[model samples]
Target: MSERKVLTKYYPPDFDPSAIGRTPKHLRKQGPKVITVRLMAPFPMKCTNCGEYIYRGRKFNARKQTLEEKYLNIPIYRFFIRCTRCSGEITFRTDPKNMDYECEKGAKRNFEPWRDSKSGKYNETEEETLDRLEREENAEHEQQERDKMAELEEKMHDSKREMAIADALDEIRTRNARIARNEGKDDEAALDSIHEQVDESLLQAEREDEEAARKAFMTANGERIKRIVEEEEEDPVPTAAPVSAQSKPAASISMPPPSSTSFSRVKKTKKSGNLLGIKKKPSLV
Candidate 1:
């Protein structure tokens, strides 16, 4: 171990360094540059050489090489792997256009339902596929144009409806203002009429009170005059003493008492006449 680790080594005194010969350039190996790599299977496939199945994600020691073909300037690479069961060679290459791998020889890839569905291919001719694509694009453009026109028409209709609603609101507000003003005038007139009626009623009440007072005064005055006349009729009148003997003898000659007829006549006269000197018709006996 110590001799192997040493940087310097012993040499024979008789050795000659110039006797060795070099190979010619034409005799050197020539081929495409290939490199060994570790990778997993990209997809499930079956080997044609040995009828062996290879599943995706299986690790392998593969030989990778750059290919002559390219897609849109992107380089494509080919890989060679051997089957695990029979050690048969399998070749596949990168497909940049589809972003997937393609089997070239020695193996066949399994069918993929998802890939077929996405490509929408049914083994149709090239011309038919092109026509279908063009028709689809035209239909899409027409649909977009129709949508834009419909949106524009809807906006115009909304603007017109809004304008009409605003006009109606303005008319309604103006009418309401006019009605309010008229109602105010009517209220003022009603107040004036009510005041006039109250004043008339007050005047009528005053007139009635005055007439009632006058009638009461007349009734009281007439009652007082009637009482005075009744008192005078109830009292008897006294005669004066005879001044001379002849008058004494005349008074002594018992004058026949005044007749009841004469007293009745005075009473009737007093009752028939008033202080105002108006005569009343005699009452029936």
Candidate 2:
């Protein structure tokens, strides 16, 4: 907790705002709330010069006045207890709040004597004006520092925003690159598929050409065999013709004697399908 600063003003014993109309005149003065009371007690007082004991309440007059010291908050009523023996005066105060008497001058209070002395000594010169000016300068310096801190904070915020924007731009670039890479990948896949389709079409064309060549060769071989068979059947062997052979020589003509093509054809027929046996010739035809 922060300690409150004591104001530089002297307050007497009986200033109380709460007791405005109810307090007595002695207790309603403009001062502190505590007061000290003094009594003329017939006590023995020792003289410091002669070392003689002097009885109090003698013809030596004692002055009872409140001593407004620098440190004491409550007005200390110093009884100048004088001794008629050697004109020696001993001063003491009665503490009214504690209801105790103390001979010691040094008492503890919230008021600081050093601070009071400093203020008093400075008030006597031009140093008070300098102190006020210094206080103003310190306040202005603190305000400047606060402004500098605020400016630095604003710069930091701007920097953070710039960094965020830069990061967003970087992310956008990355996304675009990724999208372009995906497009490239798609294009590559499509090209690969197109190349595969072309290769398949070429392979199919080769297969079709192969089949066509095989079929054409087979057709040519069949036509050549048919022509050879027709030529061999038209030219019969020289022999006496039978009556049925003279009427239909070409129909009754027999095939030529077995060569390589004929034997292969006969073997292919036997290998390929079921065949029926021919009837035996009756005569030379």
Candidate 3:
């Protein structure tokens, strides 16, 4: 047989075990009430599945079960209600400590994937999602605007380069035109100078020819005058003959008449200053 164990405590020696059934008057004095929890049977008022309003005093033979989860220490009560109208079965659960009820099918006692621990609700709403999409769209639009600005700058650069090239071409063309004009002017001036030279040469040649012809005429006239003077110097000189006395000199002669009239010729003579027969007298003499 198994032996029974006895417990002893320090108290009055006259204490009896039967006296414990009666409470003391001073201990029975009322004090502040305390809150306690109780798990009671479900009310028989309404079956959410059956849609039948069962009377409060009536008894319902409903099935009850205890559901437990790893995160919760308290047991949950599950009630299965059967509908008399459509024979539909509905289950309901209750948290005995909290006195909270939930539909068995719709009860979300497990870990919710959509809820956030901080906000205590599901994910972002439709408005928030739309706002995010709009923000992304605006960012893309800004990027496009930046690209357009860059493209415009490139086009402007090209335009400036092209404008500069066009200006340079115009300057070159203008310079060339000016040079051509100057060359044309120079050519005209050169032609005029050549004409002036040609005219001067022709005039000089005409003057020279006239001078030569005048000099030749003078030389021929000088030769003819020299020939005439030389012929005159070579001719012989003539003298007068003396008159005879026989014919007419009887009266002119001083002497008597010659015997038997036979006349004797008398001679006359003249003297020159030079012996070489060249003239020595001056032109004035």
Q: Rate the local accuracy (lDDT) of all candidates.
A: 0.84, 0.62, 0.62
**Candidate 1 per-residue lDDT over residues 9-57, each given as its tens digit:** 7878987656658756697787767999999999999999888889999
- Ten contiguous residues minimizing lDDT sum, candidate 1: 223-232
Off by over 4 Å in 3: 1-123, 187-285
* Number of the predicted model whose lDDT against the real structure is largest: 1
Ranking by TM-score: 1, 2, 3
Candidate 2 has which clashing residue pairs, if any? 12-31, 12-32
Collision count for each candidate, in order: 0, 2, 0
lDDT of 3 by residue, 148-209 (tens): 99999999999999999999999999999977866777777867877999999999999999
TM-score of each: 0.47, 0.24, 0.23
Query: Candidate 3 — worst ten consecutive residues by lDDT sum?
Result: 32-41
After superposition, which runs of candidate 2 have C-alpha atoms over 4 Å from their true positions?
1-34, 37-127, 130-150, 153-177, 180-285
